[model samples]
Target: MTATLDHTAAPLIRRPAGRPLRQLVVPYLYVLPAALFVAAFLLYPMVLTAWRSLTHFDGISDPTFAGLDNFRDLFADPHFLLSLRNTVIWTVAAVIFPVTLGLVFALAFSRVRWGGFFKTVIYLPATISAAAAGILFSFVFNYDNGILNMILRGIGLSGLASRWLFDVPTNTFAMIATYTWQQTGLNMMLFLVGLQGLPPEPIEAAKIEGCTGWNLVRRIILPMLMPYVVITTLLAIVNGFKVFDLIWVMTQGGPGRASETLAVTMYREGFILFKQGYSAAIAVVISVVALAFSYFYLRSVLEQEARQ
Candidate 1:
């Protein structure tokens, strides 16, 4: 023998260099358009906004560095406080109601025969544009001749028909209700997808072992669905903090800043008040909050998946 090693112990020969180079280059090429788009649109704006947060640009004027004055003012601003409060309220409401109701409905749909029809009907409202929904609800909640008030008066419960969109707590709750109604479809679909993907064996086994109703859900379903719950909660918080279009259309951050969230505040500061730098600061805050929550949520999801 010429002292050659066993084939299994021998190092493999490398592929031709040009072919490898071409393969590598092709993948980069495939991603080039998306990379460029993200760089130009997402990265550039984010970097610019971060820089602007330290400036004092008023849309028309040259941006001058103002150190942390804008951030300092952000803390003491009553408008900011009210907006934060409302954002917290919306976020809590979304988490407690929509997520819970969505999970309930998803389970019901999974077990029901007519789920498709019900899902379609429930999700139809979500298909409507938020702007259109706002306009429609504006009419629904109108103080004088609105549908809600009319129904209340017709039922001889006029005391409960007070201005839905014009009062403080009522306006905020009314908007939250509308948001929940519109959002139920998305939540339902997400939960349904998660439910359908679950290994049927565990559910069936649990049922066979006398685990039914809330016991099955509490012990088996909820644990598996924790990932989805975290995801939905994260989305709700981000959406709550960023709500603008519908609230703007319906209340214009009004009834005296009662319904304003961070997004509405940013819009008011940037466009209406012409405080571009300040608005950028608010934008940064929103991004920071979203990123923090997303980081934790994704980490939790990865951990859960790894365990599975």
Candidate 2:
């Protein structure tokens, strides 16, 4: 019996003498092109931008070392301060309104017969480019002959309609509303995917225990959908931080810098005003904020997923 066991185990434990050097190096060779691409396009540009931020380059002139002066000047400028504030507002509102509305729509329409039609109509806006959407909303928000104002007059609520894109806070809120309309459908689709992919056993078990309506959703459904929630919220925050095209097309960050976000400010500084260093500084700040959020949130998500 001992001889029989030894013979069987020796056959099972057979090992190769060595791997060929080419086979060992081939995996790394496969990864080399992608690594080079990232280094050239992403990492090199990031390093260059950071270096530019520390200088006084104005696109035409040679760069002169400026240290933190650009940042200091940004804090002192009222327009920059306003843009920062607007960025904060945009990030917060984007996270709240679109995400919440999307989840709500997903839940409400998941079982509806007309859900497909509703989704198509709602998601159509998201398919349009940001610039195109901005142009369309500009016409819709026209002060005089816009459809919104026309509808308001028809309903005898003309007072409610104003220069949507011309006022201070109103312009900001109008743009936010437009963003919400465009974003909500995508969020809804994500949540709907999550909902459809849910494990049915827990839901069936919950229902048998008299868990229904909001209780069932709050207790069982939501916890399972946390991944989608994290994803949409992160996307919303990043998009909010870097929003420029829509604002540029709609208002050009004006009626006097009222609706300027960080991205718009950076563009105005670098391209329009020829302040390359200052724009680079703004770019660095935006990158830092976005990276911090992504790193911490993704770490936490990984930890949670590992435990599960």
Candidate 3:
């Protein structure tokens, strides 16, 4: 009996020795493919762009070192400044509208029957390619023979129908509205997921304590869903900054650069004007801005999660 007990004990001791190795190896294997993809796609392009930003290539001749001249020119360019302002406006409006409407939709859907069907319909836009959506909105917002103008004329609001893409304020708002329509559904889905995951015990307790209506949402639901809100808002901001296809298809940054975003500017400079170095500089700036925003956003999320 003593010999048999010793043999079993030996295997148990050996099992513990292999556990730590298996744990470490399994996680590393799972992450290996993702790490390779990031290195190949994201990191490589970033490094190459930074290098190109310092040179004058124009995609034909050998690149010559230009130091910081490209950046200097970018800062002084009036068109670039306009693009920057447009980008900021786009980011702010995009984040605000999508997140706000998403929260509203999430709340409504969470409490209603047949909500899944409505949710699917709302999320449908997110499945459409941005280029296709842009083309669709182009017809909708066309100044002459457009659906919007036709509807306005029918409703006796013909006076309000004007060249939307030509006017700065209206054009900007029009583009932002299109983006909001597509993005709100995604935000709604995120919030819905967050809402569903919330602890029911607290919600029931709050209801029992007469925490009804706005109080229930404001104090109970919103707090629990803060993490989701932050994630979706950051995503909206990034997408807004990177907006190109819609603006490209609808306005072509046209009627006179009214709708030109950084991405559009980059495309025009690099591909259209063949100013590859200058375009690379703009691309570098965009990448930097995106990275900075992501870092801060992630940090805030981490801190919030820790506190919770």
Candidate 4:
């Protein structure tokens, strides 16, 4: 009887020696490849860019230490200042128009018949590449003959139609409008998702308390959709800061660089003029600005969450 008890206890006590070690290390083993990839690709490039920004490297020549000269020159250049101004305009317009229009469209679609079809139609532009949309709008805004001009002439509003991409503020606003058309659809879909996922109790209760129409939306629905609003608005701001493909394809930051944003300026300096170090400085500045925006957004979100 003692031997039988000892044998049973031995079976329970003698676990596989390697089992716990394998369990501890397996997850890290699985994650190692991705970590290595990020270090090699993402982290290494970022470090290299930062170092290069402090040196004078024109791609072909040996890099020489320049210590803030590139940044100093950047601030002094009128074109760079203009680029900064244009970037600000892009960020503001992108946020206001896309987010607002998206919310409006989402609300309208939620109420209307054939809403799904209308949504599909509106979302069609988002399926098109930014470059393609840029090219399409370039023709639409052509000086001599474009659909927009033709329609304006037909409606006796031809005076309002001018050189859309040639003027300073008009060119900037034209690009903003094009961006809005492309972006609003995605925002609408996101808001619609938020609306559909909302719990019925608050809305039902609001209705029971005689809340209706704009008041209901303003007080109850909008507050509930805060998460989606944060996401969409942040995305719009980031995209605006990074806008390059559309500007490149449409205006090529043309008419003497009047419409150049920082991204465009960076590309023209680095690739076109071969000012590698200056371009790196511009890239670093852009990254810092984008991070600042993200940080503020995250802070605001956390504050809201805490308050709730």
What is the C-alpha local distance difference test score of each model?
A: 0.86, 0.91, 0.88, 0.91
| Maximum-TM-score candidate | 4
The candidate with the higher TM-score, 2 or 3, is: 2
Clashes of 3: 0
Query: Residue-wise lDDT of candidate 3 within 126-158, one digit each (tens)?
Result: 899888888888788898988999999999999
Candidate 4 lDDT: 0.91
**Lowest summed lDDT window (length 10), candidate 3:** 12-21
Q: In model 3, what is the error at residue 42, expressed in angstroms? A: 2.7
lDDT of candidate 4 over 117-177, digit per residue (tens): 9999888899999999999999999878977887898899989888999888798888999
- What does candidate 2's lDDT look like per residue over 1-308, in tens digits? 99999998997899867999999999999999999999999999999999999999989979999999988888899988999999999999999999899999999889899988988887788888888888989999998999999999999998998999999999999899888888889889988987988889999999999999999999999998888788778878888888889999999998998899999999999999999999999999999999988886687568656755
Model 4: per-residue Cα lDDT at residue 306: 75
Clashes of each: 0, 0, 0, 0
**Angstrom error at residue 172, model 4:** 0.5
Q: What is the C-alpha RMSD of each candidate to the true structure, in Å?
A: 3.4, 3.6, 3.9, 2.8
TM-score against native, each model: 0.90, 0.89, 0.86, 0.90
**Comparing candidate 1 with candidate 3, which one achieves the higher lDDT?**
3
Worst 10 residues of 4 by lDDT: 299-308
> Model 4, which residues run further than 4 Å from truth?
1-3, 20-33, 294-308
